[model samples]
Structures are given as C-alpha cells and as structure tokens.
Target: MILERQNFMNINQISAELEKEFTNKSIEQEDIEKLQALARLYQLYQAGANEIGTKLENLDAEFQVNYDHNPIHHMEERMKSVQSLLNKLVKKGYALSVENVRAHIFDIAGIRVVTNYIDDVYLIEKMLLNQSDVTLMQRKDYIAQPKTSGYRSLHIVVSVPVFQSTGSKPVNVEIQIRTVGMDMWASLEHKLRYKTDIEAELVDHYGADLHDYATELSGIEIKMQALYQKLNQYKN
Candidate 1:
C-alpha cells in the first residue's frame, strides 16, 4: 500500500534522478527530456491524489465525530511508476509522451478506499462526488455487474483541481471503493492468478471456485451489514 510522497521536485534535477531510477533500462539521451516532462506531469497527479486523499480523510473524521461511525476502513494511494506508465502506454499503442499519458491514462494516480460495509462503499462515493470542485469523469459500477474474472468494485474516475502558483489544474484520479469482503476476495484472486506461475488449466478451474467464494463473501457482507444496522439501532 503506497502513500502520498512529497512531490516537489526541482525540474533541473528530475533528469538526473530519472536517469538514475531508470538506469540501464534502454533509455536514450533524447528520451531524458521527455522523461523529465513526465516527472513534472506526475507531480500534478500526486498532488491530485493527495487532495482527494485529504478530502476522504476529513470526511471519515467528520463521520466519526458527528455520526459516531466511520464509513472508510482505510485508503491506499499510489502514483504509477515510470516503467509502468511507459509499459501501459506502449501496450495500449499510445505514444510515450506526457501529452499522450495525460490524455489516455486515467489511473496514473489511484486511490483504493476500503470500507467496513457494502453500504459504506456507495456512501463514501456519494459524499466524495457531492463536492462542488470534484468533477466525475467516468464511473464503472462493477459491483452491480461483476467482471468476467469475478472482480467487483465501484471504479470512479474524477478530476480534482490541483492548485499551483500559476493556476488550478484539473488532474484526474481513479478511485476504487469496495467493502472488506470484496477486497479480501479480490486480493486473494489477484495473488493466485497474477502473483504466481499457476497453469492456465488450474487457473480456469479455480476461477469458478473464486467466483463461488466471492458470492459467499457477498452474502456474508450483507448479513454483516444487517447485523451492524441492528446493533446501531439498538444502541440508539
């Protein structure tokens, strides 16, 4: 789980640092200038992620203080690595330039918000998007329509202003909201399918098993939500 880092980098120093980071990665002298531009572009993305992260944190704090509940369980943020950015762009048949990256890559800055209950997932999304400055660019409700891989979550691409000395730049950030149960299943599935060298036949066999497990987890999540509501009602 990556957290926000200090994104202030001297433009003059970015080239040297980027060179060091991508050492022996088949980078040419001409590409250094382009990479520097990308580094500066990523700074805005980092700031955008931090802004949204702060908003989510503040909302969670407010919920705890005023409503005696915390909708967000935890959050993880990450700025895509340079290699990853390049790979994605190249794989998607986009030119490896800052302009193309900004135009095509929506998940350059990503935040995963995990909540305790399924209802809290939608609640947090509603609260975050209700802000005047946050503009909804795109939304994919995978919870309602699970992916073929049995993946489920609400993915929202939002643009938030990252105020700089010059002006306010609307930077895009991808936010994924999911309940603990959904997260657990997704994490496990990712590990099994991606993190290992499992054979395709085995993966196909376990894919159905994973989907069944996800369904079971979903049932349990609903039950837990019901119990939580009952407990809160009883306390009130």
Candidate 2:
C-alpha cells in the first residue's frame, strides 16, 4: 500500500481549532460520551509524550531517531521510543454514512508497533490478546502473508476497559504490530505519499536498502532479546 498523508495538522493547530469551535458552541447538540472521548485522546497524547520523552531525556544531544532526521519532530523513529494509544468516541449512526465512522477511526488511531523480529510482533499480539481487560474484535496477520507491495505487519482490533463511574466498560482500540524495519519503510512511504500523492516514486531506492538492513538486523535482535528472556527464566 502507498503512504497516505491526510490534512493532518500538528497538535497545536488541532487544539486551536477545537478551542475556537467549542468556545462559541452553546447550542450544538453534542453527546457527552463523544466529548469525553476526545478529552481522553488529548490526555493519551500527553501521556505518550511524557513517557517517551522522560525515558530518553539523557540521550545524546546530537542523537536522532531517523536517519539524518530529527527524532523529536518525527517521534516514532526511535525504535520503540514511542508507544501510543488513542481513544476516540466516533460519531455513529445506524446507517451507511455513519458506518464509515468506525472505519475512519482505524484509519488513524492505531500506531505501528515496531519490534526487532517476527517473534516479537507475535509476542506482543498474544500478550494483549491475553489481557483480561482487552477483547479481541478481529485480527489480520499480514506478516505471514505480506501484501503485494511487500508490507509486513499485523492488524488487530481489541476492546479495552474504560472505567466509568458506573463500572468498567469495554472500549474498542486499534492495534497495528510491526517491526522497526516495517516502520522505516512505512515512514519513507508516508513521506513520499506527501510529496507526490499516489504518483510518488514507484520504488524507493533508499527504502529498499533500508528494508534489507532491517530484515538482517531483526534476526540479531531476536537472538539478543531472547537471551534476556532466558536470563529472566534462569533468575526465576
């Protein structure tokens, strides 16, 4: 699949729009649940920024996540330096027009889970599926059967607990599990889509090389991370 760049503005711009829209809106019929969901989304963004930022606070001043690119601006390049979970209450109705709400949410909410190996991706997928508070709505294993365009990742829909005053209620969440290699390719692809729309470069010269490197490195990563697993077992 081609990288798609929507009319996605930065967080600051989105916030300004929201402030303006809500400021003069005393008569708009809005549901409380939808508003609460939007609030939760903003809160999650803050939490993610905090968690990743603090963990890498002491990193080298010159160190960057992407190849020759600034990590702070493009946050996801830091090899799992980013972990995001978005919550939104999509406006739903019992009709075809509203049915697209669910589709659109998946279009943007889930993050690309970049791991080092195929096993890592499977482990994460299984771990979340086993969660008592999470319900698996669906799963599409693309790693096993990669796309015609050479994309490798797993897409899953899971519902998580959202504890309301009454009790804990299940809320659906979108999860896309991949590898660092996948993220690199996806990142470049997204950039190209922005530059040329669909008619972007048919094959990324630099991206193909990066993909090969990631595939080889992933093997080493699996071995190294597995050693840690063995250590934990031995310690136990």
Candidate 3:
C-alpha cells in the first residue's frame, strides 16, 4: 500500500508538470482539479465502450441460444486518445476544454460490429436500439446509400449512461454495423487510398476499380443474405 501511494503521488506530480507545460503557466489547485476531471471523463468514455461491447456480446449470445443463430461475427471497440481528442477539437474550431469536449464530441468511444450477412447488420441494430438505456442521437445509413468512395455501413451515435461513484453520467458512443464483405472492402480500400503513394492518374484508375469492387461486393453480400435466409427459414 505504501508503494502504491508513492506511485500515485509520482503520477500526480507528472500530470501537474505536464499540464503546466502545455498551458505555459504555473499549475494551480483549480487546474489540477480540472485535469483530474478530464482524466475521469476519458475513463468514463472507455467504460462506455466496454458497456456497449458487453451489450453486443450478450445480444449475440441470446440469439445463439434462443434462435440457434448468431448474427454478430465479430466486434471491435476503441477509445480516442487524449491527443486525438485534442486534435479533433482544434480542427473543428472547438475550445480546448473538458466542457467543450463533452458538448461537441460524440465519438470518443467507438464500436464496429461485423456480421455474417447484410440483414444481420439491421437485426443487431434494431435489437440494440430497442434497449431502453440506449438513446439514439444520430443515424447514418450508408449501407442503403453508399458513399462516393463505396464505403457502406450503418453508423449510429448513441448515449448510454455509465454509473459512477458520484452519479450516473450519460456518455456518447459511435457504433458502426456492417457485413463481412463490406468490412473487407472498406479495410482494403482504406489502405489503398491512405497508405499508398500512387500518382494522380493511377489513383483515379484505382479509385474506379475500388468502386467497381465495392459494387460487386454488395451484390455478393445480398446473395449471401438470401442464402442465409433460405437455410434458416425453417430453423427459426
């Protein structure tokens, strides 16, 4: 316990020094308090992501036991780093304060749910949204209307209350639901567009090819969905 307390004190000292450096001013009690609060807020966001992940896992388990089918193939959850959050706030012309971050940023925590079939995406979405605690703040149906770059997914921003020592605080989390095919194309497309250094004309050529590939993937996903429905028609 003594060692732990020493470590904690050292961490606090480091945090205060870092804050002072960033602000270019002497650290005061009020600033220390604000920094602690900001740290708690990030912890809350990570807890929110974990809460959503648990909900998705539970739903998948329920489907498997009750319906003999599992909709969710896999899930990925992430929390935005402090640097990333600050960068985004600056890019969006928002003030660099905890208050502005809470008010403006809704995607500090994110989850991506990948399903086997396209319809499974909607099924999981409906089930999740039906929960009372999950409040839908925004919905963007890119699957129905694909992006110009051929990215397709159902994006939803939701607020879920996370219980804390003080009280229950509502936290925002962004959810993306898509089929395996869509996820595959999106992953590769992102790499090609962002990681490569092809010339302008070649980039255009690759872009067209990627668009065509996305279309083909969509068609394949639809067919796979139909096949799944036919196979499980009598099971459920």
Candidate 3 lDDT over residue span 48-124, tens digit each: 88788888888999998988888998888876656677788889998666899899998988888889888888998
- The lDDT of each candidate is 0.86, 0.47, 0.82
TM-score of model 3 relative to the true fold? 0.87
Clashes of each: 0, 0, 0
Q: Tell me the tens digit of each residue's lDDT in model 1 across 102-146.
A: 899999999999998999999999999999999999999999999
Residue 183, candidate 3: how far off, in angstroms? 0.8
lDDT accuracy of residue 5 in candidate 1? 46
Model 1 off-target regions past 4 Å?
Answer: 1-30
Q: How high is each candidate's TM-score? A: 0.89, 0.50, 0.87
Residue 5 displacement (Å), model 3: 28
